[model samples]
Target: MRKLFDDHKTDLLVFGGLILAYFLTRLPRLDLIPIFTDEAIYLRWSQIMAYDASLRYLPLVDGKPPLFMWATSIVLKLFPSLDPLLSLRLTSVGGGLFSMAGIIFTSYVFFRNKRISLLAALLYLVVPFTFFYDRFGLADSLLAAFGVWSLGLGALLVQSIRLDVALILGTAIGLGLLTKTPALFFLVTLPLQLLLFNFKTSGWKIRLVKLFLLFLLVVIISQAIFSILRLFPLFHMISQKNLEFIVTPAEFLARPFEFFFNNLKTLLTWEVGYLTAPVALTIAFAFLRGQAVKQNLILAAIFLIHLLYMSTFNKSIFPRFLLTFTPGLLVLAAVGLDQMSTRLRPSLLVLVFVLVLALPVYTDFKLLTDPPTAPIPDGDSKQYINAWPAGYGVKEIRQFLARESSQYPKVTIGTEGTFGLMPYALQLYQKDYPNVEIKDYWPLGETVPAALLEASANHPTYFIIYQRPDVPPNWKLRLVASFQQGRSNDYLRLYQILPED
Candidate 1:
């Protein structure tokens, strides 16, 4: 044991430092970004699943798979006293660590260099796209972890044709598929791994037959796990909801290039924002260099096809969806960095990496300290930092209501809408507060309703509005507190409904 430790001392130190860096970025300030609309829904589902077996498949009603909720509910059950959203975020932290380990292992397999393995993890750590998701309480992080392991093991299976690798790879793909539908890309790109197969070896005919047989086993295993969803009646809703986000192949063929260029432009713009142009250049450089050409091409094809397919057919696309491609891209980028390092002096190599990684590191800093200033895509900024859907003032609202609840027999809280951030967020926060009665109101006319004024006459009633910019002065209400939702013009305003003058 002592000899083993001594032999791998440098490797241990490098990985140790990488793990420290990962936690430093992931563990702190988890509440920095407030709950999002989807988060409110997901966390609520997790809360439901944890405490009630009757509602275990609640998310399936909304066309979401139940695995992410099941995973999160375990955290909630384990730490019953922890904040609900915090528990959910910790689940994603586990997933991020899984992907980081996969990056280290897969990079070593492809390049056989310890430094490249370290560098790939470092890239995943620093890139804002990954950094943002790792700390977030979302299914995408776990889904990406499964996708990374699937690709890594698939690459190994093609060369080794081992049954153990095939079975493990199938499990990885199955978990990924349960997490999200994007795991289909794993099957779509599996054929590319054929480039790594040992066709030059004797008895190639039998080898090909064995490979196909194992591939069938993989399909059977993955599909069998997926079929568990069929026990629930709403299993078809997954495909139905999937169509809402992506265009059908026939639909795309009808207008082949209508959204292609614009979507690609937006996606590449986001890529540069998070990954940095220099790192992207390095990924390109990996191909130009002749080393590990087969592995490089396979990884590149997997990532490029994913981007191209989404760009060509997406009805709506967000940067988080691009996360599944990160492990592959970062590993490929690590290859380029490794190739460069081999030709350069140590001092020059350090200088090159620093220059290539500078932008992503700066972006991470902004995300950590001042999220509103981060260079994320506008859609992400709107969803996470600066818009009505973002839960910027949710904590403050909860605190205010909790304080008010102590003074009243039953504190009635009204929000702008019935769905999403308004009602769901407050619902999750006040799970144990039975004295609180929450209601939702929408389509506020030119003036506040007389119904509220009548209620205000008896006692002070509070209302929270988040959906719009306009506040009617004629609403017979006095402002209690107003919070700017990040840097946006949008504000979450709390008002005390006043009696008629």
Candidate 2:
């Protein structure tokens, strides 16, 4: 172990610097992106799991695996002083750091080139894709990290044909499966590692048999780990929930091109915008490196196959789903960058590299300072910044309620929706104020809930609405505060339900 450490001592030191860079991108103003519906839901689950032992499986109620929440729960426990939302965001930061390291190791392992590896990590550091996602509380970044690790370890297993490597690879995939259902594709793609196998070597027959055995061990280990979810009957909800986001096999066969055409168009827009069109264009230069064509083919497949498959059947697709393996595209682009560094004239190369790096760096700046106008797709603004689902007013609402509770012995709050931003986000901050009582209502009718009216008799009762188009006249609501969710005209309005005269 000491010898191995000595051999890679420089690499280890460089990686420490890279990890620091990652946190610099992640840790500042972690809540800059307002807690959206999903973050609210996931972080709320993490908060619940940390407080209630029996509810460790709470996310399973929504068809999500418990690993990201479980991990976030640990963060919440350790950093009790930290904002629970910020603490939970650390989970994605850690995952991006892990995935950055995986990019370095996998690039180096595949091509035996330290320059290519360093470039890969550097690209990951600056790319808008990682920059935007890594700093948020989401499971996609963690799943991407596990997917990248599995890629690196799968390569090692193929080259060494070792049971130990397969064991490690399977463990990574198992953890991924425990994070998101999309990880099952990792299990499906593991066999493609044979593309890296050395058929040119002598004693090929025995090596083939050993490879088969090790591969089978990998399947056994990953599937066995996945079966842990089966302990709870809600595990079946995972498959059921999947039907909501993807075309079933039967649906796919029936209308393969129906959604595929438009979905593919949207995905390409997301990829080009986030990937930075020039950086993606440079991936073509990877072919110039003159390594085994099969090696490049497999690496490209890491991103390509997943994109195509998701485009084919994804009913509820988002740019984040592509994050799992799109860093592989960066590994390929890193090779291209490395090759240009060697082949181009010194001055010309500098110009090319600077131009290539400019957009992603600028995009990162916009994302950190102001995301609504960032160069990425409008979809981001719709979901996270501008839409009803956005949490533009959530923090202010919490602070408002916190103050109201202090001024009065009892404060009653009503939020628009039951499950996500309204109730869950508000509930997360409800811990300290014993005087505050928050209840949720949905499907607003012509009149307010009688409970809100009853609570109003003695307590200051306030209701929060997010983009409720036709707030009922019978609500007798007076606007206490209103903030535009984003550049969009939609406002998150706080109204105190006044009792009738």
Candidate 3:
């Protein structure tokens, strides 16, 4: 057993097996949740892409990138129906599975220890947050997969200065950027690494200058190609949103301290929630004392820079945004655990095992069973039936709708709050009912009644209202069913041209 543990090859296989098991557990349960709002957008947009050329446009929320939509477009082409919860979500699942492989490979490549890489893989596979997001229809998992690969390639280039590695690194970075605009955080850290790596080379200044020009060239070329394909849609959107989103230099200058403080707080809130103080300290300690000082420092810088960027937004910093930094944290956490594994005596194995088992159990219980605080002022009512699409209800809702419903020419679903998982679910369910009509709306929006009104005009027989009871009484609708448990609730309401009342 000791000898087996010592062999990295064996450890890698063991870890890979465990990850395979993890993916299996989640993949089979893919469409378990009701579709959430953002997922609805992606599903609808991608479905539009299936027929109309104009609908290929990028859908940006909060200045985020168009990569997820672009990827979703590709999946829609393959499946055609574009099931938000199942078909579309499967892409994320595949991306996540590959990301697990990337995590293990990147750790092995960086730390050069099978055990440490395995430890990192174990940490990633076991984390409930990681698993929850992995199965959902989102760009986070896809971005993370590419992000880890980009960072690994960049780090490898820094160590070797090989032209081929640099080219590959550049490509990965470009793809990552394409995945999410925030991936600029990784790209930002690369040149610094290049300068550090080549500080001793002949004509260091020339090398730096050449590196800068090459970086610009690669960026320009990639953007130009994507621009032509996206037809400069993203740039146009930026120009359109500039008045609303852009901050003046004077504003930033005037509140420099306050800006920095607030940004740091937002970043820390989600990060700290995921990693407790002890884990944070452990990762920090490893950075200070680890052998790969330069690489670790770069990782730390990336984490800090991203936190700083995310903090500037005035909106509430969701914990899911932390997904962008998952690869970095996972790598660092692996290093931290490896450091502990080595420093601790072999006699302490049992104590470590107990800690390992205890943590994930506690986290899973909290994530799966504990309902989130409602979006409403009164905690008695839940705004969203589920915050994310990783529960028994989510899956049940998908299957029930898939099995029971027949396709309509057009249909709109009224939902309270943002139901990110619905579009994906509809896409999957629609496979069995090709003529299904599905559109999404948040009940709080002025547009909620528009769908019901449209349905009443056409008198579409089927209605799937996520918050049926909570929908305003003014809306011409009657509830057929309400799915509720604890504080959470979802409903299905139907409407007609003539009021029964």
Give the poorly placed runs of model 2, Cα more than 4 Å off: 1-9
Report the lDDT of model 3 for residue 102: 79
* lDDT, model 2, position 191: 82
Between the candidate structures 1 and 2, which one is better when assessed by TM-score? Answer: 2
Write the residue-wise lDDT of candidate 2 on 364-418 in tens digits: 8888888777777776768888778888888888888888878999999888888
- Sorted by TM-score (best first), the order is 2, 1, 3
Q: Write the number of the candidate with greater TM-score, choosing between 1 and 3.
A: 1
Residue 343, model 2, lDDT: 87
Error of 3 at 44 (Å): 1.9
Runs of candidate 3 with Cα error greater than 4 angstroms are 1-19, 51-55, 58-66, 76-84, 194-226, 229-234, 238-250, 254-263, 276-278, 288-290, 313-316, 365-477, 489-501
The per-prediction CA RMSD against the true structure, in angstroms, equals 2.0, 1.5, 5.9
Q: lDDT per residue, candidate 1, 1-501, as tens digits?
A: 999999989888888988888888899888888988888888988998898988887888888888888999999999999998899899999899999999888877777778788889989998888888888888999998988888788878877889999999888888888888888888778888888888888998898899989888888888888788888999999999999988888987788878889989988888766677888888876876688888888888888899999889897889888888878999988888888988899999989988988988898889889999898778688888888778887888788778777877767767788767778888987855557777777767677666666667765577888888777667766788888888998888888877776
Against the reference, the lDDT scores of all candidates come to 0.84, 0.86, 0.59
The model with the greatest TM-score is 2
Tell me the tens digit of each residue's lDDT in model 3 across 61-175.
3344666766777777877644544766777877788678877777766667777677667667756556667767778888888777777766566556466766666666677
